[model samples]
Target: MDQNSARQMFENGAFLVVLDAPTGIEFGIDLDTWETGPLFKGLKMIPPGIHYIHYSVVNNDKQAGIQSGFLHSFVSKEVVVRRWCAETEQLYPSDHVSAEDVERIRMGIRDLDKGLGAYPLGSGPNDSYARWQKLTGYITPAMLAQLLPPNGEFSSATGSVYEDEEMEEAQKALHHATAEPPAALLDTTDRFNFTHSDIRRSFPANAPPEDIRKYSRDKSWLLKTLLSSRWHDNPQDLLGELQLAFVIIFVGQNFSGLEHWKFLMHLTLCCAEALEDRVLVSRLFVPLVRVLCVQLAECPQEFAASVLEQDNFIAVVLETLVLNVYECSADEMRTIMEKEIGGLRKLLEERFSWTLATGRQLQADADAEDGEYAPQVIHLD
Candidate 1:
């Protein structure tokens, strides 16, 4: 009813914007022979919003001697507003809610609340349960209860699809389980990747709470396999194998280029340092890692990597630190007679020196004429 509420509702809604090739740019190039345009199109991220914008153009003929080619571009914008039933239905401001839909919703919500549940979705790839998820949103045991046959009962949704008691017994009898449990069914698109597929297991916005422990368990199988590998083996023979595994992992995981590079860098850095003497040596591993990290920092855009599996951005920072310290610990610093602690201290000093040099170089390279932030100032009069 109020202006503030209207504005808030509008901002929270979604929008669909379509961009088309521009057409008909004219000129007074005598006899109207001037062209539509030349190539120059890009995106500018406007404040807080996701936009799917496309850039395209039509050129009847490309220039051979700067005498041909025309360009055109255009965009159409629209919004998707989530309006209230009363306003859209044109009912009175105080019109009461419908009793039947309310009852249906109440029963649905109650059924979904059970700790465990199962829907006899279809036997097909996308069954009734999958449809239910798209419509209702949350996963819970209670909803399963409501969906059971007239004489059936409720139970906590637990274990694998076959491990749950009711569902298991029902399975033996050749019947579908009515157990309603909150679960995000796996999408066919993400089954291959260990990480992304888990994203589908979300409860609908208001679905019941179903125990998701098992469904999410499969997500870690690949990670467990990698961690079990012999990280402390002979570096001369094993580093190559481990690094190959890492490359595959980095490519498979989704994120950004920077992310994967950083993760690979961090894990490799650890493996290098951990096995640094008998089986491996930090001195050798450090240099290889430095090259990778330096390359990662220079790249733009997201990279693919398991580093995202690590909390926050630790993988990125860790790799950068590893590269920084390894540069100093490589040769002259690889002295013996020195305790392990002393080597670590020297490596740290090297990292600090690198940081100082890098900062100084960046500042020195700034353009004074352009009034960059690094411009030196003498304030005293």
Candidate 2:
């Protein structure tokens, strides 16, 4: 593009991102890979929207690679400076860039034009930005602030509670004997570590008295309690936080995040009435049920009722599935109901003597159809 066009674009607040990395490192933003120049500078006329930046480092063999990515929302004329840490094999954010360095780079974009790659707006939207948006559309800054790991920590470094639970008793005993309990555990008054009681503390102190009363250790009560809270005007705020937890698990590779996400999802499913009445929440019932189905199928004996619940929690899933089967009409919804939900119903019936009203209705319907088409018996036969 001509200098005049570039200057015009810059005036509209396009982003200039500078990456300080080894020459051969494969750097990319969204779906477009930058052709590595001397300084690895990317000057893109971003359309003032959310974007994802990703990179992978070639290992010593130049064959193996380690990948990391992040999401950011850009404003016009935003200059983001990041540096790749060869030692840690990670990328550091613009926080490390000195003001002078940023100013110098910002002032000299024209002079360094030869080294910078323009944003690939010509690239089809589907192949690049649109795909990234689809993957991350549910994630928002508020969700990130509440769910993303503090500082530079990712999910891998923070091992899950379930993971810690899985250690052999002997190994745990040995490790506990040698290790001092962390300071967080030693404190008597502060017990907020994502457990039942801990989750209650998430609500603002000024929340309504009725809302506060809803808190409980039972996983089934989680969604009910959350809905009762005055966290935001819309229920989706809480759901966005839940989605962040889920995304952190699957995308962030944080099993601990999944544990939390699943805990919440399980609880939400328990509230069968909400899945029927609330439009905001009913929409999520399908995905939540799908996850539960996969979890149950993958490990049939993995589930157990919450200690805090008065009756069998497994019955809750059964009740919800029955409700969903009768009410759900969408093709995707019916498909999941037939495949995952239907499988769960069968599992419950065979394993626990549980019965499905919907299953009986389906059988009745089929029997009625067969009777209608029954052939008259012939005496000659």
Candidate 3:
């Protein structure tokens, strides 16, 4: 972006470490790494304890723009935000908070929970944020749904663990907060009992039914995927969860069942109203490739309007579908996999190597960056 937006990123608690990547090096240092020496010449004035790290440089050349990171770290980490658009402030957001303010904010959190601001999930009122804390251990990029107003409003009490009555009361409060309208509510009356064999049923009469059946019946595949779904409260309806788990299971490493994930994803979208655990729904998308399907699944008008807004999730989603899926076509598949095919079968198999690959191996002809940290690199190390 511009110099203004860059400053905004620094102010927003981006852990903006200035790696000493000065231009014109015979052999360059990874500016993204820890600066072991006094490269900043004291201009960076780093504080001693719990200080938010950052650096400023007028590189004058093209060594700017951290590829796609300004927005990613903005959304990922607990970065501070100055959101101030004033010219000078835009020029220097690092000046937004002083040493005194930093200490005050840290101590304020200490005061909130006697040194722990975040209460255990399900402990506080069942507001959106509380559900988020419950779903994921801590709020990260996906847990934005957990943000709630401070106490004295619709907050749930997060009292001591030993207080049984308080805990019960907290539970009650959370249920109310998480409650939804009738249509949005799931059919809790009838428990769905699904079997691994039940998922083996026909898949469109004209398709490869036998091959699909083989993958579904693979118990080893079913079990591995089942581990994530085992915690269902109503164990009786465990089958329905299992059927959904099939999307991840049947696909396995080869990703044969990608079409199934696409079907399930669209089904989730048809019933666009969430299960009061939007953050859980979001974090299940830790496999970055699912980003697009998840966004369409959210189905918010305002959100759709802001889809063009720069967020790292959107960028990675585009890269996965547009770039990687195209690469898969070299194997002579006529129709390339569409974004509509959910569960991101290709991304899951390729991104994390989710298969028991024995003799088979993935080898790049030349040096290639591919991994979680791959997208972040701008210059070669």
Candidate 4:
């Protein structure tokens, strides 16, 4: 930006004040990261929006520690203050800071301006600012509150009680040997409110057996019920949750985030009926495909490899989605869906050497297999 525009933004933009953060620690907002210097305090001239603020503690050996972060919504000209807990190596709200001290610091903000870095806004659509917005477009502040921990923070190390139960015996023994038992420090009650773990039980408890069987075979009912009940009034929120889970996995590197993402992908792709809904097609699937494209493009190589592995959950679901769109959707919707799916296919082929068969190809393969497996008529009959 030019000097005049910079000055205008500086006057109107939000501010983040970090108190007592260790020098040399890694700090970042959105897609930009930097090593903290002696004079570093926080960020300034931040554009108003929802943003991911992440950091990693620098250990004695100068290696970065586990990544930790949280999502926050900033309003124009707002000031957000947080304090670093040296003992815990985490950032927390500065509620304990005295009112007079905070006021004194605010009054001296100009003196501290040199210590704060301006938020980076890249130059184009493919830049950090624009990409971050696209990745988080559907996410709202309310959704963050519902999904994040009670402390409103997430970390690579975050785990649930259920995860603890699933841990290997050797891992449990290792944790027991530590001075501070990780499990003991963990908040057992803290868990993300993703969709139900079991799609088979998505139906009501008292529902008829046939209804249960139908729901098991086709998740259209489950999809509709979740939209009406959990994400009521806006179908877009479903996409929002999916985006949120992906960001959590991509940025936070949290395992639970991956599980949540997988569950949502299955739920979305299996719902053939949703392909027929105009509102859902436009608001959910269209943007969802775009989001997935970006995510797949930017995801780590290991993650991409896992997705492309033979018969993997994501790969299988994507194939199912293609078949559903081709067979069940109207011509106009199918055209749109095919165009989007084509882009995804191209990306997969270019990046991973994985080919996703078209709907016709899949059908042809199934037909050939059936013919090969067909029983011959008996001459006696």
Q: Which ten residues in a row have the lowest lDDT in candidate 4?
A: 180-189
**Which runs in model 1 stand beyond 4 Å of their true positions?**
1-179, 188-263, 270-275, 282-284, 297-381
What are the TM-scores, per candidate, against the unseen true structure?
Answer: 0.23, 0.57, 0.20, 0.86
Q: RMSD in angstroms, all models? A: 26.8, 12.4, 22.8, 5.3
Which of the numbered candidates is closest to the native, going by highest lDDT? 4
Candidate 3, residues 79-193, lDDT tens digits: the string is: 2322223232121233545666555543442232221111111225554333322222222221121111121011012111123333556667777888832232222221112
Which candidate has the highest TM-score of all?
Answer: 4
| lDDT-sorted candidate list, best first | 4, 2, 1, 3
Candidate 1, poorest ten consecutive residues by summed lDDT: 66-75
- The regions of model 3 sitting more than 4 angstroms off are 11-13, 16-31, 39-101, 104-381
Q: What's model 2's overall lDDT?
A: 0.53
lDDT (Cα) of model 4: 0.79
| Tens digits of per-residue lDDT for model 2, 137-252 | 55566555444443323423354444444454546676688794432222222111343234435333665866555433222345555556534435555455455554444444
- Predicted structure 2, TM vs. truth: 0.57
lDDT of each: 0.28, 0.53, 0.28, 0.79
Ranking by TM-score: 4, 2, 1, 3
